[model samples]
Target: MTEQTNRPVPNPCVGVCALDENDLCIACQRSGIEIAEWGVYSDEEKREVWRKIHLREQGVLKE
Candidate 1:
């Protein structure tokens, strides 16, 4: 069996897979570039992305 390393942050993709007018994913609130680069980012980087997402959700940041 192939071994799997635990992901520090679970992927935010909810399979909505659509970008809104501002180019942020309607579901996960991540930009297309962020989604594309997610797999290559380190855990720390992923955490940072998550931070931004949470901020957006809370209206502390914009898309």
Candidate 2:
């Protein structure tokens, strides 16, 4: 039996799936490329992306 030490992070996708003029997703606030590459990103990378998303949501940043 294998022990799982890693838990997958919850996806930020909200089914909006639309990109703005800057190529950033209007709903999830992820860049189109980031959304495309999300499946392959490591947990640390994902966390970084999440941090950016949260910042955007909080109006602390923008793409």
- Top candidate when judged by TM-score against the true structure: 1
Please write out the lDDT profile of model 1 over residues 1-63, one tens digit for every residue: 223336467899998999999888989999889999999998778888899999988989886
How accurate locally, in lDDT, is each candidate? 0.86, 0.85
TM-score for all models, in order of appearance: 0.83, 0.81
Off by over 4 Å in 1: 1-7
Query: Largest lDDT belongs to which candidate?
Result: 1
**Runs in model 2 with CA error above 4 Å?**
1-6
Poorest lDDT segment (10 consecutive residues) of candidate 1: 1-10
Q: On residues 1-63, what C-alpha lDDT tens digit does candidate 2 reach at each position?
A: 223227676679999999989888999999998899999998778878899899988988866
Alpha-carbon RMSD, each predicted model: 5.1, 3.9
